[model samples]
Target: MRVAVTGSTGRLGSALVAALADAPFTGPRGPVAWTRADLDLDAPAGVVQALDRDRPEVVVHAAAWTDVDGCAREPELALRRNGEATGTLAAACAERGIDLLVVSTNEVFGGDREDHTGYAPSDPTAPPNAYGRSKLAGEQAATDAFERAGAMGSASLGIARTAWLFGPPGRDFPHKILDAAARALAEGQPLRAVDDEWGTPTYAADVADAIVELLAEDALAGVHHLVNGGIATRATWAEDVLGRLSIDAPVEPVPGTTWARASVPPRWGVLAATPLPSGEPMRSWQAAMADYA
Candidate 1:
């Protein structure tokens, strides 16, 4: 089971490498190979070439254009990375009869709903922002590739949609909040955060572990929400991080409108989780955060 992982330098990608390094299941017979530079989002042809060369049993697609506001500003770039690249990679894997596990996002559901409940895998998708639209396009492209490949060389595609991931090797929301708190404390100023936006804050390691589990499962196909179990607002998450850091800086809770950001923030709760057919829940966000601190 030689596995080829893209975006080896990203937050989740790095964690996936580390997880596979320590995983007992990934032995000599099932080695995990990582490619960061040679096969990147900009070079889809290179990605296809790498897949052909490696002929890996599984290809974990993690590279993407993740900047929400940037996606809104430059949709063409987003489409190139998130949409076109994904389609190309899926086609490549399909041609070689290699399984592909695509890492997706909860943003596919426009966070405009009033309710803050968890979104199931079957929920209707209505992406409000350009980033979500591009990710949704990637998902559709992967599915289409599998369909086009037919029964002969089609690969098994699993779209794992996650949310609010944070961890080492990259900047995430928790790290950002902690850094802002530290800066505020050093400057003797108050930290302000948006209290309205709500979602699950997942740890990258946990998401990586879930991906490994999903890969090992036999009947795990189609779309699945792989987020932590709990939900919290941005302000609450900020306060929690501050508390973990032993910083008492006053975290001012402000509405989302106060931020005045370029991109349209998802107002409705974006936190989501779903049990696999195996009846196992994803890792807990609290435990993942504890590891972060």
Candidate 2:
């Protein structure tokens, strides 16, 4: 099957492109990478025109305004880019009968609960911040589009929600931790991290692989939590990365309140994975990090 991925150069997008190339199910056509220059979400006309030009069997919408703090500062722009743009894409895809899989976030769940377990796909959503709300809007928009097209249960629409995603080609959480370790070592201070904020640190390549498996198994519809096996607090995750790098810099555990940001993330952003095509648990973040390091 021919597949195209938006946000071709992004952390997860780039990984998806690579995974698609190696995936046997992609067939001889391989994968097409659509950058923003090719199809900007801000311009619905261009999106529709581009979709018509490319005409891939499947479109994986990976582009988004992922700057959480920036989204908080400009909620309207976030809604326009992350929410309304998604609706535009979903509508176009549904009209053309093209399968669409939207990459979403676990932040859609309000982490107000003081529980240790992860959120399932069927859990009630109550996003606490603008970024989460915007993403949730995108999810709803996709669902609405499919339903309007009389294809709600056709398995042609999908939402792949992931959490704490980290990988190469960008300054993700693990990269920041490594940078902080270097800075702390030079300044003679310990790296401070939030212990209360717990999440599963997912690897981008792994998520891409899972997404491919879902498509191959014809299980792309509905919500799927494609996260790592285990959960870790910010401090513990930082410690693991530092240890893997052989950096002896001490890490100080602190509450989430101590590390303030413009946007408020779900303290419990962990997402429980559903049964994968392989019928095995996703790899642990530790093992993925080992390969990354």
- Return the lDDT, model 2, position 170: 77
The TM-scores of all predictions, comma-separated, are: 0.93, 0.97
Q: Residue-wise lDDT of candidate 1 within 1-293, one digit each (tens)? A: 57777887788888887776666666664445556555678878777667666678887888888888999999888978899889988888887788888998888887867655777778888887888889989999888887888722356788889888788776678778878988888988889898887788888888888877776664347777888888888898998888887878899898988856656756764656767656878767777778779
* lDDT for position 167 in model 1: 81
* Full-model lDDT for every candidate: 0.79, 0.89
> With candidate 1 superimposed using the best TM-score fit, by how many Å does residue 203's alpha carbon deviate from the native?
0.6
Global CA lDDT computed for model 2 = 0.89
RMSD of each predicted structure: 2.0, 1.2
Q: Output the number of the TM-score-best candidate.
A: 2
Q: What is the lDDT of candidate 1?
A: 0.79
